[model samples]
Target chain A: MNFDFTDDQQAIKRTAHDFLADRLKPDKRRELAEAGSYDDGFWNEIAELGWPGIFIEEDHGGQGLGAVELVILQEELGYALAPTPFFSNAAAGFLIQQAGSDEQKERWLPGIASGEARGTVGVVSNGEAVLVPDADSAAVIVLVDGESASAVEAGSAEVESRDTIDSTRRFSRVSANGGGEQLGGDVQAGLDRAEIALAAELVGISQWALETAVAYAKERKQFDRPIGAYQAVAHRCAQMMLETEGARSAVYYAGWTADNEPDTTPLAASMAKAYAADAGWRVTASSLQVHGGIGFTWEHDLHFFLKRARTDGHLLGSARSHRDRVAELAGLSRAAATA
Target chain B: MDLTLSPQEQAFRDELREWLEKNNPGQEPSGEQDMFKFRREWQKTLHDAGYAGLSWPKEYGGRGATLIEQAIFNEEMARQKAPGLANVLGLVMGGPVVIAHGTPEQKERFLTPILSAEEIWCQGFSEPESGSDLASLKTRAVKSNGGWNITGQKVWTTYAHEAKWCMLVARTDPDAPKHKGLTYFLMDMEQEGVQVRPLVQITGESEFNEIFMEDAYVPDENVVGEPGQGWNVAITTLMNERAGLAFGSAVAVKLALGDLMDLVRERGLEEDPIIRQRVGQLYIEAETLRLNAYRGLTSQMKHGIPGPEGSLPKWQWSDINQALTELAMDIRGPEAPTVDERWTYRFLRARANSIEGGTTEILKNIIAERVLGLPRMR
Candidate 1:
């Protein structure tokens, strides 16, 4: 009945937290975000930690950790608001590992796992993936359309850089034009795992926003005392805490479901993604509200988090879409016969 | 993180589930007295099975279940929709308080009756004037004849009419501070000076009552702790009220959600996109509440003290339950206002969830001041 991390999982979380805090400090993150580029050296340093392969199979030249460990790393990445290709690469890894054929896995899993030749995944809509993160830099790209997915080498696809409000991560519009190998196994399973990962990231962003808001509320004074002493401000901060913790619980449960309870992963993942998508944006925006004018400016790091949260909310699926899926999975069928 | 029940926990749950399946008294008859009688009988059945006071120590005639087992017991009860025990307040708060703070003689006199449902208990903490700021209660207990005479008005007391004992908190010392001057007493409710009047709620049923105590007598032996230390003892009772209830409440929400989905389908509104989204959101919120409760339980087990995070599930549960009932009404559409017993009753009753147990505002304040270390509004 324990819902806490094991000793080993706790160690992984602590290590990731410390490493990200040291490696992707505010200055370094801001530098990369402003430049609209990731530092290759920084990416290499993360690769050295084996996080890129955190959930890939050991036989495929990677660490055979579960989704829980991947969630820990993604949460830290989101908290640091680091500018890297980690999420995109991991999304690709999940797709290829879960849905790729034996031969395809042999060809690409090693590269995706080792971090030497990375991959990215995007949801294809109307023959084009409109918001593919790190598509231009990936060695391979997995384009998912409904139940099916395909792996296309970067050179075989048309990748155009797309500037987004979140400059911390790069995005590209990708079109493979039927020039890729189709993944043969369960694509929705991989997508569910990816959604859980994204949800974990949102949880991290939410936690950061909540902490930032609480700290600011305590230190900032208005009229006679700290604004936090006022219920108006304090309750807003408390609501943020509620949402953040709720999102965290959902995401962690989804991650555990992915690793252990396969049958429940789809519903669990959608619940996580839906709750977190709303919570991530709401908490960050609330934090900005708490900061007043300072949070609105580009100079404050809070904007970066806010933008990232908004971008993440729409990346895999918006809250509305995932919620729609949840309704279907939960037996709210549109078919009249069922009703 | 392992969310699955352990082997022992699973066995315990299975045993209780089987027992409930066999001994389950299907449903309570409608009238308040009839329901109370039904529940009293059910509690007797549970006591015979050693299920009542399952969390109390073995020496006190309990199973001495671990926290997880107690949580399982709660979740299963809510899941099976089992009839609630007649001595809920006694089992949850009074028995635990007596065990923690009572004298040996007090334990011998109190604990067994609470388990057997021979004596039911009700709390007397909230007054009309001191609902949230409980320490400022005007309830006065004047010492005389090796006992005390209490006089005050207490509101929002559940089971007051049927209760044999009142876990009353009153001011025993007028000169001391508001918090320090209070004392906890096990006041006899059958006395001539004590009176209970039903407080009709929005649901038009009196699940709660306003207790009027005029010169209510309590022997000095009935004091659970030293006089002037009732505040701390009362805090223990409040903590007990909050603990081990999250799991049950979460399950209850899920069950209500299931009923809501059924209503949606029965009305052929399941296909409506707006209804679907609302239902989906409710499902997500329910899951979040359940998971957060599990996370809280794990942390409490590890730390041996529930943290401020404990405030979250109650707050979240209130929101989810209220939203769920409102959605049910919305799904009912033109039929929403029509008196449909179950859903209509639930819709009106849910308004008190955020206010009762602890208001959502107070919970937010606790999270802000205690959990986040924000400045207190004081």
Candidate 2:
């Protein structure tokens, strides 16, 4: 059993890494984040790269890949903390593709895949979705609330822009009010895929935070030698490595299960979401601790990552909610019944 | 990436599973000596089936299985709750070191007996003074006629009383640096001037012993590698001790977690949200450990040697096992302090999981210095 990516997958990852590194410099990301808006130029460039359609089927005017490939791009975007509509658009695509009717797929999949008419997805509770990313600009918005989802044309729904601590991407409070078409397919399957996608982004964010901490530890000296020489600092960095790597393992395995092992996806997706949600916050917070007072300032790029990690932990599903699901899926219910 | 086993691997697993199903010896008896004898017989059975030394080279009387195959072997054995081989130290560490660095004569003399369980082995690297800093060990070996005279103390030597050979490391050059003056030797444990005393642990068990060697003689041919290079040889043994064990340990943790879940249900605490959260966290950690191990294995298969990432699974395993046992006790409620036998023994024994092979602190140091490229404290 090989746990590494295939040659083609490796090439996709390297390409994404180099492309993001070149296009989304720290200053560029800071400019967009500070401006509280995304650059249409950057979104168009990513769309030209066909990343928005990386996992969409070729029949729908897309590249026809799998969840693994989609995660590769999402991870790179998270690492760069790039401000784009990629994730929201992709989330909508996954839901429509997996849970929509044939007519809904035909109408929305092509536009979502081409990145011309982007879509966004949000979880609804009590008829309102409080945190729908990119909803203001989405061509279509998919709102899901337990077992059922509805797709609404952006103009037909109410979308009020909301500012989150994570300004790298935009969010909105949405309400469709019975104005959209119902997606009557496997909604949980779509939600599971979306959870795995979020988990991958968290892995990327954790990796970035870990690398930033290690670099800072090696360069920042105190009382004579680099602070890393002290176990107090070094052990924190080590703990960051452990959490980041563990989240990574969980996310990658979940992505693979989504593509190859359908029956295991529900359990695997919740595990990934649960582990990565906690790990993202913990690793980034630990990295901030490693940088001391500087990490606390707005001038440092580390805060952006820390904020993104915190916000991401609450999006789609919180760690506690996913852990509850994991308990049920992993045989807690079965054990209780047997007892 | 494909997580499923290949056809050949599946076939290998099927064959081994069938064999085990037919010849499973079940559990060992109580008492230390009885368990040791039972394991020895089990090892003999494994040797006859060509299962002992599964990862050693074919030229050295082994099956020469691939790393994945060896991992599968470990996973299957642990899955079946099979008794461990009596010559574990010999097969995993001693024979591998000899095969990697021994002369033809040394290999011929040492390989077969270890597989057959005719000559059990124990390790002598740690001392009371040299627990974490193994290079500072005071065990000394001096030149003699056709042999070397060893004198010093070694603690935490498992199975020392039953072992026929001790894979000993001694300072051969007193004038050299602490790490450079060492030599690796296979000392005969039956010789005079050698003593083994059981060291009772917190669990009131003497699974480990202290070895006292006052001028114990080891013939010149007993050295596994060149003189004064014992540090590197010992490193090889430590690496072997860590490699490929993750899969087995992961399976064992999974089994323990299953039992804990059973206990949780049996205690009527399954409806407790806090208990459920704890169980869920343990389950996730256990899975993370297993997945990380597979990633490490893939890296090792590509790079020939495992990267510093190998430390991750060991650290994770210790935490998971400890947390799991503690949760079991918590579920046991007011009866936790009483001797419930299985859970109590496991709860006490798991305290050593982090301290035994390598302390969690030392593991963190390794990951920080080696994996994360942090500066060394020294």
Candidate 2 per-residue lDDT, tens place, A136-246, comes to 999999999989999999789999999899989899999998789899999999988988988899899999999999999999999989999999999999999999889
What docking tier does model 1 reach? Answer: high
The worst-scoring run of ten residues by lDDT in candidate 1 chain A lies at: A330-339
Model 2 root-mean-square deviation: 1.1
TM-score, structure 1 vs. true: 0.99
For model 2, the superposed segments whose C-alpha errors exceed 4 Å read A334-339
Residue-wise lDDT of candidate 1 within B1-378, one digit each (tens)? 999998999999999999999999988899999999999999999999999998899999999999889889989899999988899999999999999999999999999999988999999999999988999999999998999999999999999999999999999999998999999999999999999999999888999999998998999999989999999999998989998789999999989988998898888787788988999999899888888888888888999887556679999999999999998888788989999867999999999999999999999999999999999899
Off by over 4 Å in 1: A335-339
Report the CA-based lDDT of candidate 2 relative to the real structure.
0.92
